[model samples]
Target: MNALLFIVCVIIWGSTWIGITFQVGHVEPVVAVAWRFSIAVVCIGLWMLATRRSFRMPAHMHVKALSVGLILYTLDYSFLYAAQQYIVSALLAVLSSSVIYFTVLFRRVFLNKPLRREVLVGATLGLLGIVLIFSPEFTQMTAQQGLVLGLLFALVSFVSAAIGNILSENMLDEGVPVMQMNFYAMGYGLFFMYGYGFMSGASFTYPDHLEFTLALLYLALFGSVLAFGAYMKLLQRIGSDKSTYVVLVYPIVALGLSTLFEGYQWTLAAVFGVILVLIGNAIAMGKLNRQLKIS
Candidate 1:
């Protein structure tokens, strides 16, 4: 079950990079993200209603949803969409795996969980693999204006996402229902996105292109709802630290799609990077069959 969830998440999220790229030109990135969550919230809300899931939650849980909405949905995605304008989505996807380290650090500091050596080492190698995978893009950095800023925004997005990951894990540990949490969190996320759009004076134009339309629907339905559902379940099954190994694997998928869409070419370094990522995944999650059964 855990393995299935991990695969589902990786495949969907990896494809979302290409979908986000299609969104780059049609609408303001902030508004595009806002629209994506708007659609996602409605779907989740309907699904919750159909299943008879109660929407009731304590005040603190609402607060948690708000925090997640602001940091994860609003900031993380807002910056991510913006950064795609300045860099290819594959590079941004690769950069995102850094969240593993941040998640681990926050878990250690806030939750008082001791850092496990093997996970850390595995994550380090995974990060290294992603860098090597995108090393060719880095070489062009000298000629790319705003590349540094784009990279900075991507970093901010990853950190915000990592913080949100920790918060969600805590919420799950406290017995918060996943579907209910996502519905409320996405609602608040949509609210924050609208707030940000108004404050920034970003135009709220709807996209009419076929690619953008398809991308928006896919992002909302599969990327936002299904992918997150599977991922959160993985968090429930395996701990957050290990579930994040999916991050390492999905960027490779992003790059694979990039080959066709973004003109990304595979190189010797990239091949070696893939090999390292596989090794790291093995090291990090090698005991998953045992751990899942034990848990």
Candidate 2:
């Protein structure tokens, strides 16, 4: 069941970048993200009501959840979309995979948990893979100030995401159920995102084609609803450290889809990078076997 959920998340989230790309010309990124969450909130709320699930959260934790969601969903995604305007989508995708390293660092500093050596090694290899994937983009960054700014924003997005993960994991530890927490968090995130869009004078524009609307629906339902819900559930069940291996696989899936639909060229560097990423994840998870001898 967990493996199935993990694969579902990878596939849905892998496709989310394509859907988001489709949304770019119609509405401002912030506005699109706000709409996505608004739709998801309504759908999830209805489901909770129909299923007779409790919506109550402890009064004290409400603020925390809202803050995390604002940082994670609202700000992180906003920066990511904006960054895409300046950077290649493939480069952005690779940089986003660095979230696992940030997750480990944040866990150590804020939570006082010791970083595992295996996680550090995995993070190093994963970062190297990202560097190789985005080598051309890095050269562009040195030439263009806007590109540099975009990279900075992307890093900020990763930091906020790590903060959100830490906060969510802590909340889970405090006995907050994933569904209830997501309900409140997403509601708050939507509110903040919409508020920001309005304050920024972003006009909500709609595309004339049914394809755009269908893409939005896919992001709201499959990406936001099913993927996020499944991921949070997995975090609760397997713990955040193990659950985060999903990040390692997501880019591979995204790259594969790009190859199929976007005619991305297969290269030796990419293949080698993928091998390192997979091996690194395996090592991090302690799945590598060691020989033992008994006297």
Candidate 3:
């Protein structure tokens, strides 16, 4: 079940970059994100109602849920959407994986979890892979201030997401159902983004093409609903330290898509980097050459 959830999440989120790409010119990034989450909230809410899931939140938990929602959806996504304007999607995808390290840091600092040496090694190799992936962009860094800023914003977004994941994991430990938590969190996040859109004078113009429309739906449904649902489930089952490794795998999926659709050339460096990434993930998972030894 965990493997299935992980694969589903990777495939769905991997394809979401195409959807996000189509959203480039239609409306303000935050406004588009707000609409996506708004639709997601409604869809998930209806499903919850149909399933007869309880909507009640404990007094202490509501605040934490809202706080996590704001950081995860509103703040992180706002920066991400804005950063896409300046950076290549592939670079952003790679940089986003750094969340694994931040998740580890938060775990060690607040949760008193020990930082496994394997995780640190994985993080180092993964970061090196990101550098290789974005080496061309970095060459032009002096001329591309916006790109530099975009990378910074992407890192900021990553940190916010990592923090939110840890918080959500804690909440789940306290007995919160993932779906119910998402519904309320998404609702609050939608409101937060809506307010930001209004303040920024973002327009509500819809895209004209069917491609964009379908992409928007895909992002709202599969990306936001299914992917996030699976992710939160993994967080609950495996804990944040392991769950954050999903971020590491997502770039590989994104790179595959880029190769297929965007004609992205995979050089020798990219292949080596990918190997490092896979090895890093294996090391972090502590599954390096280990088979199930049943007595």
Query: Which prediction has the highest lDDT against the true structure?
Result: 1
Whole-model lDDT per candidate = 0.84, 0.79, 0.82
Q: What range of 10 consecutive residues in model 1 has the weakest lDDT sum? A: 286-295
Residue 187 of candidate 2: its Cα lDDT?
92
Question: Best TM-score goes to which candidate?
Answer: 1
* Model 3 residue 237 lDDT score: 86
- For candidate 1, report its TM-score: 0.92
lDDT of 2 by residue, 10-94 (tens): 8898788788888876888898888888889899999999999998888988998898779879988888877877777656767
TM-score of each: 0.92, 0.90, 0.91
What is the lDDT, from 0 to 100, of the residue 273 in candidate 2? 78
Q: Give the range where candidate 2 is weakest over 10 consecutive residues by summed lDDT.
A: 286-295
lDDT of 1: 0.84
Candidate 3 TM-score versus the reference: 0.91
Please write out the lDDT profile of model 3 over residues 1-295, one tens digit for every residue. Answer: 7777878887888778788888877788898899899889999999999999999999788898888879999988888888998887656766787788899999888777777667777777777876676566556655456877888889889999988988888889989999998998889888789888888788877777898789879999999999999989988887887778777777778879878988888877778878877777776666662542211
